[model samples]
Target: MARHAGLQGAGRQRHGYFEHWRRKDAGKPSKLGANKRISDEALLVHIKAIHAEVRQEYGWPKMWKELLARGIRVGKERVRKLMQRHGIKARGKRKFVVTTDGKHDLPIAPNLLARNFSPAAPNQTWSSDITYIATDEGILHLTAINDLFTARWWAGCPTGPPDQESCSQASRSFRYRSANGRPLADNRWR
Candidate 1:
């Protein structure tokens, strides 16, 4: 039938294209103008139907498949072009994070460390800091120690709410865990 139509070796839409859409009841409306007359009411209905079919997640290509399943012999390019013109697009998943404000009326210490970073021996000066860590159980607080001279670290404890007691606990951890016999001072940061 195609050879009889004389579309031999045809590259694209040329002749017999109407055969694909041949329906006795395909009363494809009137020759309305492009903008004012052409309303997407029907197409939008079809797209929304497709959207619901995929739980409102499928994009244009899959939506086009739904149209093609209904004996709608439209080209993929036409569907893609129509979707782009109508601002159809896919969305991405997002992950969220939380932030805290430490600038309230809570008692805060001044930064006296000032990046001085000078020490004669391993245990002579140590810097300690408390931080929060998320885990499978819950939010856990951590206390860490750093020696300024050899820059060695003291393994500390992970707990909740690193308060004055936590700092005192870290001081004891540094005392018992040090190999170098030099004493450490907890002087305020300069």
Candidate 2:
């Protein structure tokens, strides 16, 4: 039988070689049983239903797990292929937001430092800035005050965007007498 099928003696001895050729010649399904398998259209229906239930928040991994959890037995790679073919995707979380209004008619702060980052002494020139940090809970607004010469810095995590009050609070916390007694650099320009 192996010689007729063009399989050598060693190849015939390999597991499932004869069975595979036998099934192929007979036009029968393999041992894995194709009878229980549903059509791609049917599977896609289930996938779309689950996607809507979760508000399209689950990718292939989560979607496959959800299918298994719901008593629908399917392969993970199959789920991924179907989702990719059908243009199904998870809605990603927004990581960045434009907080600044550049078109507004707001008064800009003057550049007092004149690009001199290296100060002669500590407290001679203090700078402050505001930034954001992403956390599991939400985004945190960080207001930081820095002494250019000494490189000493203080930071405060405010609830919302760093406003005048938040920046003032951060500057107040870092109590150091400035050499020229100038206020902390305004962060509104940032």
Cα lDDT tens digits for candidate 1, 1-190: 5534654455545433544344323755322311232236666667666766677666778777788787454567766777778776555553454445666786666555567688655676677766678788977878788788877777577878656777677777787877654434342321
Clash count, predicted structure 2: 0
Q: After aligning candidate 1 to the native by TM-score, how far in Å is the CA of 183 from where it should be?
A: 7.7
- Candidate 2 per-residue lDDT over residues 63-84, each given as its tens digit: 9999989877889999999999
Candidate 1 — worst ten consecutive residues by lDDT sum?
A: 29-38
CA shift of 107, model 2, Å: 2.3
**Model 2 clashing residue pairs (backbone):** none
Q: For candidate 1, what is the lDDT?
A: 0.63
Q: Quantify all predictions' global Cα lDDT against the true fold.
A: 0.63, 0.76
Count clashing residue pairs in model 1. 4
TM-scores, one per candidate:
0.42, 0.53
The alpha-carbon deviation from the true structure for residue 34 of candidate 2, after best TM-score superposition, in angstroms, is 14
Q: Residue 121 in model 1: shift from native, Å?
A: 1.6
| TM-score of candidate 1 versus the correct structure, residues matched by position | 0.42
